[model samples]
Target: MGIHWKIKSFEALSTHELYDIMKLRSTIFVVEQNCVYLDLDGKDKVALHLYGEFEGKIVAYSRLFKPGISFENASIGRVVVDANYRERKWGHDLMREAIAGIKTHFGESKITIGAQLYLKKFYESHGFVQTSEMYLEDDIPHIEMKRESC
Candidate 1:
């Protein structure tokens, strides 16, 4: 079966959905990865959230920003997919929809992302190219990448 997609702003999120989103982000970014970085950086209200829910759980998610908010250009961040759903290849699907939403809602032609270094190839497949040397954010290796509007 295919995943279901939901894109909404912080205000539009139901309490339960908001909880699930935070839980998933923490589960993967904090507990799973063992990274204690601050996840809530006062940016949610300005972002458009993208989630792929399956059976009432947020299996995949990302937060998209308009230009000059998170980066000098529009960007996508906090990309995550639940461990249980990894085998289903939902990450790619989630990102494709996120990029589409960026184009549709923001009319943005270019976007930047500070992606985990290991997933560089994955993001490149979607047209994002590395634009900077690798750096550590919260002790995890990351690189800046950008994709121009297609």
Candidate 2:
């Protein structure tokens, strides 16, 4: 199966779309990860939401921020792939579009991300390089990474 991609601002999100995004986030980040951090960090109001849907259900998601929004540089956050569909590898597609969205919409090639430690190589394959030491966020180890351009 292939993913149908959508990118929109918080205000542009329909109630249903927003619900699906939140549900999926909670499912993966909260329940599955067994973490209790606040998912709504007030950044969504300023970020662009990117999600992939299959058969009317959202299975992957991420939020994109312009430079100076999430970090000193444009960033990608809240990356998640539905546990049920991980074997399908839609996470890669979600990331490829998110990177392209930054260039196409924000005219930025340099991007930053606070990625979970376990996915360091996954992010590396997409051109992100670790730039900070590992630290815990909501009890999950994470590291800062940057993609200089392209």
- lDDT winner: 2
lDDT, model 1, position 147: 97
Superposed model 1: Cα runs more than 4 Å off = none
Q: How big is the positional error of residue 33 in model 1, measured in Å on the Cα after superposition?
A: 0.6
lDDT of 1 at 52: 93
For candidate 2, lDDT tens digit of each residue in 1-150? 588999999999999999999999999899999999899888988989999999989999999999998789999999999999999988889899999999988999999999999999999999999999999988899999999997
Clashing pairs in 1: 109-149
State the lDDT of candidate 1 residue by residue for 21-125, as single tens digits: 999999999999999989999999999999998887789999999999989889999999999989998999988998999999899979999999999999999
lDDT score, candidate 1, position 114: 97
Provide the global lDDT of candidate 1 against the true structure. 0.93
Q: How much is the lDDT of residue 82 in candidate 1? A: 97
Count backbone clashes in candidate 1: 1
- Taking all chains together, the TM-score of candidate 2 against the true structure is 0.98
